[model samples]
Target: MSSTAHEAPPWLRPRAAYVHIPFCAHKCGYCDFASLAGADHLADRYLDALERETAAKLGEPHEVDTIFIGGGTPTRLEAPALERLARMVAHWLPLAEGGEWTVEANPGTLDAAKADVLAAAGVNRVSLGAQSFQPRLLAALERNHAPEEVGRAVAIVRDRFPRWSLDLIFGVPGSNIDDWKADLDATLALDPSHLSCYGLVYEKGTALWKQLQRGEVEPVVEDVEREMYELVMDRLEQAGLHLYEISNYARPGHESRHNLVYWANDAYWGLGLGAAEYVEGTRTVNTRDMQAYLKRIEAGESATGPNERLGPEERARETAMLMLRRTILGIDRADFRLRTGYDLDTLLGPVIVRFVGEGLLEDDGRRVRLTHEGRFLADRVLCEVV
Candidate 1:
């Protein structure tokens, strides 16, 4: 899609790109991302640095097939700054016709002005981080948004964007089955086109992890969490949202294209602090240090923090891990061989046969997917094979 003669060959062009917005009103207990609260004063400088980073990509206008602007609360940017950021990105990373352009927003942060700016700038989708509709659970998760704010954000989004998603967290400490079902009830009331329900995870170094260490909270039983997940699948399907991936459900044709890029093991560009990019068979992660990222941009140096190029054997294993996450459409054997250059039978056939016999994996000669029993034990099964 490049217009210049010096551009990389078509094969090297990225089909997807991601932009990071790293400011928030306050940090959530479970967040470990490069976000700074009480740093609204740095917004102007951060935007300037982000533009510089985008410019360094220097190329004739080219179209990316998908663009996802994620955050530390992308909606935290003021209306004008948000508008400018949207325009700057559109100018530098033009979208292909029908490309999926999405921005992630927190419940209370999104306003009508921000929604208008996003819609006018061609952001056709919004993913609202509405952790829970239950006030007690929201507090437990340290999410700073009223339950009412979600419906308000949903109103703003639905009027402008036809495709929007809600993020809900289940398995919060002390939450019972009724509470989990209530969260689902509230979400379905909005009639969202897409939905993601994730179980609470206490990532190391996060406040939640420290709380666990201090015995301030107890972990939910694994059996209960699994039951919550099964409920999510059943209720969402009954509500007409199909389970396309383990954590994601969507109405027809409304699946997240950008996230699908990662699950499909395809290439994408990541711009901004703490972002990651996978392109041309190499994976690169930018520094999570905001100052380091800004300084590299100011000096016109590569902000590419660290990267790895996987060997053929490693790539095959990685592909298996990612593809199995897709509950419905699992690995395509022909595509696997074509993409990884590893024969399915020669490399993983034995494990596939064993799992199939164990009722963990189902292989239909062309595609291999997890059986219902296998989905619950996905992590263990994938580890054994990978």
Candidate 2:
């Protein structure tokens, strides 16, 4: 696990790369990503700067195991622009054999031309942002796409890609258990290979958060939200998808390898506006301001905004926190020690024993994982662990 003076550490040799696209056709009310709405004029310019930044970061083409292009709807770009973006990424970051290249798309923005462009660019996986199957819930979330658009998008993705994933949101304001059940049923009918079901979060400064404050929206009660999550676990598991992470489910062999790099706290390369990269125990994020990122790249300056270099102890604790998010394979004691150079018992023995007594975690001496009941209070458990 340790490296010699002349050798490069394993964490420094990242196999995953993430590229951020910051243009969205319509910015959702609840979103806080570093994306711009009605910024179509800047699309080409953004890609121009992205090309420069990628070239600067990667002087020579680097092969990676997973490459994810995510953002304010990567599909929002015109077909030609999309093709340029894809080609640029492929040029700078060639894929390793059997590597997974994924693109995030919105149902409203995807079309046959765009889908074909992605497929032709070596994109083997597509994760469609099908937030919900219910019209009312979609409207409540300020989603521009109609419920029917999801099916059409899925059909296009299925035809071109080997495997695809769908994202669903529960606990939307005014939603109930029946509505959640209906959404689950509709999602299963799509026969998606992967699913990410998340609870709606009303982050501060978002339109939805303001509505909650002004009494314009009635947020889902905590108990109801918990019930919706439990239902998702039950329904998805019964449908043959394994709960790989707390919010992510996938059929065997279809799990998101790109995201798994994150849950395992492995190093990765993040490029473009507001993207964050971690390598050699240091994490740096590009500026969230699009113009700032462009100017920095144009001036041949660092686009990094804020960064931190974690010491050994900080990294070990963080590694534990992230690894615990994997519901099925939690933390392997031997692997943890190998990766972090820290003994699991010396770091978190007391915390583990306490939570295990509370029936929130299970430690069979070899692996440590959250139990079924522990998942409901995972956030609380994780907070205490860290």
Candidate 3:
């Protein structure tokens, strides 16, 4: 796409873009994302509204190095709709050469035709939601796919996309250490370039959360969960995947460039229903209601819900907190100073010293990073930083 000649609005142009597709075949019991099952009937209207929303929010066509299409399940869209969405992006946004374009897929939804369409539309990366490989755990999670479907989907994806990522969840109600290892082994057998392993957390309003409260399901023991975490790190590292973030591991050069924009606190434009954007120094979120989003777009009104402008010190604190989530940690002192216009030590000296003393942080000669223990309690550490 041709770049727009006009200067980008301070809150519009971003280095990365995240587009949310809020439809799924069925919502998992634990999911809280703004998504619904059987919403494909509104797919056409959603696409139209999405384009309008994009036009309103992204006033100038800037070259973006990373584009991440995530959501309930982007692959749930019909092939033609998927192609249309991809083309809409290419037509409206300038993409850098060899840019990272990724789409999130569910094993139950992806097929050969869909994979081909995505590849043809310049989608070079696929992140499959293969939460667990065990049939029992799959049932527990209410995932639609059979255990074998993950392998088949991976094979199809790897045949089409150069880079593929698999998302796995550990710490299920009945998940034992052996089962976790088996899941990891099954995933690695497919030879994916990236893996995102996450510990299960029960949100307050989810069905799983209710079940947890009612004693219908048991949470994994804290020490056992910690052991599972270590297992992932050890096994994935042996498989040659480096731990990039607390929950992400990647082979060299296969890291998710789009998500790094978030972890680095860099500017990004998020479009579509329930999407959030951080551009320049302001953050905005679109309405979660599909009807409201469409109505606003049809009326030629901004679909944004609320906007917040971040001041200099606030931005610096956010940057530090976000960067700390990465294994590489915050950049060297000079880079941090340049980005925030303040000395890193001056702003966070006491917190850093305290965490370092507690063995939760490490200050290498060039950069600071979270220790393994620190990653497990990342929320606490990040709260202290921000």
Candidate 4:
């Protein structure tokens, strides 16, 4: 499963690409992405390295179905720099006709000019980082935007782009039911095609984690968080948004096609610092160090990190776990058999029966899916299945 000198492209052509832009105006208190603040000076070098990595991984003129430019905060780039990066993608790995091109933007950074540039450059989708609408909650999270800025950003995006989404965070320590409901109401008022809601997590080495150690903030109780989650689901569904993934809801046709590639366990190429890719049965990631990534590109070197090659059995297990995340794409018994050369019924017979009996799973002859309660504990269920 090693990459040969010839760069062994797998039998299946990659339908997706994820480009990382690791620059932010300021990092959030709970952030751990490979992003930095006060690093705009490295923009030129990083773009050069990104283009090189793009060329090396995808080669020239390949047509991919979807392209996602995620961040630190992609909107932090100036209009000209953003245009350059977009044009490079168009020139190198041209997207398919009607392909989805999504860029992650922060509300504070996404100006109308930059939004227009992205639209003109064939970016059809924009995902805004409007984590919260409450100013006090945002201050606690160390986010910079005011509540008004989110509406303005959404207006600009809706006016300029063909499709757009908003990313929201809930379950913050100081946030109450009223605050959470208010955020949801504000978000729905904007009428975004897609919405992603995430529960706040305290990762080690993050500022939020440090605050917890210093007794500055407390973790939200699990029961309260679960209640908030239920409220979110009920509200969003009432507004006609379908819950596509655990944390994602979208209008019927507005689901993120690029993200679905990952959830479906398909191959993709990831370019830029700290980007990860899964191809040819191996998962590969680029170096997280920005300077090292740039230097290697300058020296015409590949900036790949450690690689993991999965055997057939391992790949099947991985695929099952990922596919189960999508509510619509239930696990097909026969397709699973063909892909893994293992019978799902035989391999997970006891586990499936137990879950089904407990009302955690539903088996409909040819496939299986998570029940409502099962969706909440999907992580634990996935662990059991895998």
Candidate 5:
């Protein structure tokens, strides 16, 4: 694709990379990501194939500004395997100076030895999956780790990684406002550099969804869920953490840069099982099936499955959906045009006008952003605009 005159500093290279590790001790009932449980027996084989795939797909060292290794739980691997995985990534995806390297960890899987390996391999950030501090909530979420393990994991991360993030989930089947507030307060006590609070979504095919279907469980009422979200916003802001994106709060200069790459619709490299990559106007996803991915790599065949070349107009609409997630900054009119070659108003003028009149968005003649009321209805607004 040719760059438009408005595309200042056009993307010529990818600065971010994502590597997926699918092995986990247990798969949570709500997870739909590409992750395998009781797959430890295949760990060595998986790593071997991962190494070959990395070398084949990204020949030579590619310098990246950020590399995020997400799970089934990257820390699920034993010490030796964990070290090898870390080193393989470092060799193929070398980090630029002051680059951010993050690894996702489960509280039950992370230990002192694995933490040491990550720190030694230059990992600077750890995202701990601490769903909730309440035992009842934890059981409801089907998370394996005890609430106390979360504090232990945080201690390990704090002693090694310079920056760390904590994750919390709300609106579980039986949770109430008091339970939600306690979770928030416990999270605040940890004093993390970053925090992500998400309302639970029941995806089809998951155990949780099945439970809901069988009448074994009922989701939190919509009214209570809305209240939980409002509480998170107020509490995090009061803690001096600014809302950089919906569901994400960070201290100044601590925003997730890799995620920002996605929100800005910039190019990035993705590797491993079910990973998706977008570069040079094309999007491709690796095979989601573990055995199939391994077979393709061993046979020296392309592991990529579904792929698409996004057209200019389609890319522009998608960009609007993503950039709107940054509630504070929203969409800058000039920058949107520079990045997508489509004037914000010319492309979606009528839709924006409707939303602004509805008090779901703020159009200040310079930028288009979500209103406080709109944040609660973000999904509806984004759906209409896109």
Candidate 6:
């Protein structure tokens, strides 16, 4: 939609916030986030700077609908430090009643004290980074936690929180369909309300990427990866965790509200190093450098690195691309025009017609969504639309 003269457009109400915690015990082989290992000493300083940055940006109290504290393992902070961070969230975040407050944590590192701190801070959901249950696959993925730790964390979260999610990885170097099945089964056994299954991506500059280049580690073939993804869909559905987003499965009412804000192309606020925000047709990201981010926030300077103001066409295209990722909540043509003042068919008529004719999309006049075949070839179809 067009940006009005209002400083914060009413059309883009701020309902979501993402807080980044970039401290970790170690970096994984396949990781490239703005995380620093052996940086526990920086937590106190980072938190102090983060509070300043948050206060500077918030301007006034915002009744946030969802708050996600993601990380390089937020639990890596010591108990008192974690409590301090949680207190910051509780103090400034102003989470709405029964709002979703989620914390992303590593399995083994989340001790009882940390869990207690998060629970006390009103964090109602915990997303555990339990990539896989197999020890061999875990070692190959450079995960330090044992399989048993996942179960322990799940038990603790179950007792402390009302909802939780598990993140599982498939298409590992040596993993097969059966191994994936085993992992899915193990995850279901933990009784999580949500599950996010992702294929292993060998990003450039990661240790895994280098290993692939050096022929030290082989990635799962594309065909195998597709099969594993299909398996995840089938197994999660059978286990009652229905597919919501492409890579996320949730029991009814357990969907990740914060992430859906991005998929729905809505506004959000992000704080701390490397965090991204989209508010009122504009997008910006904080500096990825830890020291720079801290210094900038502490010095009362802008920490945002890249900034862009998206025009109407740009917003519509982005919204279409993102909303199309939803398995069930397809794009509504009438609502689309109301939101963006653009005819959906005019914007993507040719692309949609081409894919729909090819049995990739189902456009029933009112709404448009991917067919099963389209979902299988999502990348190709999305390329056509975007």
Residue clash pairs of candidate 6: none
lDDT of 6 by residue, 45-138 (tens): 9999988988888865577779999988889989899899988887777787779999999998998889998999899999999999999999
How many pairs in model 6 have backbone atoms within 3 A of each other, for residues 3 or more apart or on separate chains, i.e. clashes?
A: 0
The global C-alpha lDDT for each of the candidates, from Candidate 1 onward, is 0.87, 0.91, 0.88, 0.86, 0.90, 0.87
Q: What is the TM-score of each predicted model, taking all chains together?
A: 0.96, 0.97, 0.96, 0.95, 0.96, 0.96
Better of 2 and 5 by TM-score: 2
True lDDT of residue 267, candidate 6: 88
lDDT of predicted model 2: 0.91
lDDT tens digits, residue span 1-386, model 1: 44334245322457788999999999999888878788789888889988887777645455788999998999999999999999998888888888999999998999999999999999999999998999998899889999999999999999999799999888888798899989999999999989988889899999999999999988889999999999998999998999898789999899998888888777788889898987777888888888888888889887886689888798888887888888888998897787777887798888889999999999888899998889888888789768
Which stretches in model 1 have alpha-carbon errors above 4 Å?
1-12
Residue 225 of model 1 has an lDDT of 92
* Candidate 1 lDDT for residue 66: 90
lDDT of 2 at 362: 97
RMSD of each: 1.9, 2.8, 1.9, 3.2, 3.1, 3.0
Name the regions of candidate 3 deviating beyond 4 angstroms: 4-13
Clashing pairs in 3: none
Per-residue error (Å), model 1, residue 149: 0.3
For residues 1-386, could you state the per-residue lDDT of candidate 5 as single tens digits? 21113222324357789999999888888988999999899889988998898888777677788999997899999999999999999988888889999999999999999999999999999999999999998898899999999999999999999999999999999999999999998999999879988999999999999999999998999999999999999999999998888889999999888888898888888899999988777899999899999999999988898789888998999889889999878999998998889999999999999999999999999889999899999999889777
How do the residues 223-305 of candidate 2 rate in per-residue lDDT, one tens digit apiece? 99999988999988999999999999999999999999998898899999999999778999999998888899999998997
Could you give the candidate ranking by lDDT, starting with the highest? Answer: 2, 5, 3, 6, 1, 4
Q: Write the per-residue lDDT of candidate 4 for residues 233-331, one digit (tens) a residue.
A: 899999999888888999999999998888777788888889998877778898888889899988888888889998887788777788778776667
CA shift of 68, model 6, Å: 0.3
Q: Quick one: how many clashes does candidate 3 have? A: 0
Error of 1 at 35 (Å): 1.8
